[model samples]
Target: MKKLFLITITLLTTLTINAQKVYSTDQSYKADVKVYVVDQEYQADLLVFKVNADYKAKGNEGKWFFTDAEYKAVKKIYFTDAAYKADLKVFFVDSEYKSGWKDKSKQHFMY
Candidate 1:
């Protein structure tokens, strides 16, 4: 029973660590990923949806929860004006179901 409990706890911890909890940083040097918001969805490498709760931010599937503090986030992102300066280019989607990687090549940036 103790082994089962430990396994369950470890699984939950791993899932939480892999969750898309992001913090927006003002300084680019402090950011883990430099992001650019594309005007059109076609121009984006990823389609992102902002979730209200952290628990809803699951996986690296682009469902992001903006954390109040940087310590609470899995990743820190800085928004760049130029697309060329960004590590990832994203487009905000209205629905969570629409959130996912448009370009699989740039998927590693979130991880």
Candidate 2:
């Protein structure tokens, strides 16, 4: 039981560390998060809450500070031309609880 508990904790920690911190990048490096532009808020896979400050940001919310340099970004994201090209299909929800991946298999992209 203890071994399983430890493994769970370690896995959670690793996932948190590797979670994407999205930054809109203009350059050539492959984006960690490939975003799609949905016409309706309901069409999005992740309902992104844009927080004013990075410190205030929690969970999926944060200040997406656009960086000229690709390396500076924690997670580089590009807007896909079509929804099919996107790794994850997102819908912007009004409430925090509403935000999540439409396809559960692609949940790993956000975290």
Candidate 3:
């Protein structure tokens, strides 16, 4: 029983550390993201990442989508692209978000 308990704890710890901070790079998609508005700018509070909200990016979706030049913050970020001046979406990683898309479906990995 003692051995089993220790092993279980170890496994759980490992999973928690490596759990991917997942989110959609597209704002239109809205992948359980936390939207924020600040001083005529929008930011996504993504986890496992550091994002920048200095300018409005062109695209807002996909894996290889727009990542903040500063990758130390969150998932992605954007301000207002002149024509579209308004608060943008700020996608972040949270316990609530974790379960949001958990039931959706995993993308097939082909490598």
Candidate 4:
């Protein structure tokens, strides 16, 4: 009886963990990120999210923020950005806005 009770609790915990994963933004491949002012508020949205969030959000919490609409946008990036070009890697800049882009030739990260 105790074993069965424990199993039930375990299953419920797993389900809870999986359900909260719809909100995250991260990707391994190249894609465009948008920068715009919404009602004077700055924001950025990834071109790839729904699938990427689901697959990669497992460990990406706090690393990125996401919304359901951005997830849907990922599915149509190609058609929406036909003439838009994207950078090589994904960049999540700080809240402060900057115009110049980083060079791929230089090491932007250091461990």
Candidate 5:
């Protein structure tokens, strides 16, 4: 009985953590998170992996839906032309596990 219970809990926890739905907001102030695209991979605070489908995007992997309105967005990001002008700088990674925040301070922005 204990083993079964543990398995159930583990499965539930895995599913919850792996699920990620992100929305890019039009306005920065109304956004849950702000992001900047860095010119070089070494300068990024987070390494992002954009999956083709929402289901394929898990954990740090994200499938972003850009919304016209602030209220409709789950997370808001303003892409700055320069890294110095942005808040959180990110680099696009190739895999999910490799996709994570290099700067621990910026970690909460994604979740």
Candidate 6:
């Protein structure tokens, strides 16, 4: 029973660490990552899907759950007006299945 409980705890911890819980900051200086929304899908480095629940925001596979408070977020990001000013360029997709990194080179920015 104790071993089972420990395994469950470890699994939950791993899930929580990989969860894409993000907070949007108003100030660019306060953000961990600067993001820009691209007009076209092909112009984006990442295809993002906004998940309805926090638990659904698993992995750095472009699944994101926006947190209300900064303290609850794994990453804090600021939206940039220009793609040149941004650290990452993203395009929001309608479906979760469509979410993924187009440029695998920029994948480490989320981690």
Q: Cα lDDT of all candidates, in order?
A: 0.95, 0.58, 0.31, 0.32, 0.65, 0.95
From the highest TM-score down, the ranking of the candidates is 1, 6, 5, 2, 3, 4
Residues 16-91, candidate 5, lDDT per residue (tens digit)? 5545556665566755556787667788887777766655655654444344555544455766566666677888
Candidate 6 lDDT tens digits, 3-22: 99999999998888778999
Give me the candidate number with maximum TM-score: 1
Local accuracy of candidate 1 as per-residue lDDT tens digits, 2-86: 9999999999998987899999999999999999999999999999999999999999899999999999999999999999999
Candidate 2: the clashing residue pairs are 44-90, 44-91, 45-89, 45-90, 45-91, 46-90
Per-candidate Cα RMSD to the true structure, in Å, reads: 1.2, 5.2, 12.7, 13.9, 4.6, 1.7
User: In candidate 5, how many clashes are counted?
Assistant: 0
Give the per-residue lDDT of model 3 (tens digit) for 1-110.
Answer: 99999999998765433333233344534333333333321232222222233122112221122333334223433333332442333333423323112111221110
Q: Which residues of candidate 5, in runs, are more than 4 Å off?
A: 1-18, 61-74, 81-85, 94-98
Cα displacement (Å) at residue 15, model 5:
4.3
| lDDT (C-alpha) at residue 19 in model 1 | 93
Query: What tens digits encode model 4's per-residue C-alpha lDDT throughout 7-102?
Result: 999987664443323322344232233222222212222221222344443322213224365443222111123213332233344432232224
Query: Model 4 — TM-score against the truth?
Result: 0.22
Which residue pairs does candidate 6 place in steric collision? none
Off by over 4 Å in 4: 21-111
The per-prediction tally of clashing pairs is: 0, 6, 14, 0, 0, 0
For all predicted structures, in order, the TM-scores are: 0.93, 0.59, 0.23, 0.22, 0.61, 0.89
List clashing residue pairs in candidate 4.
none
lDDT of 6 at 25: 99
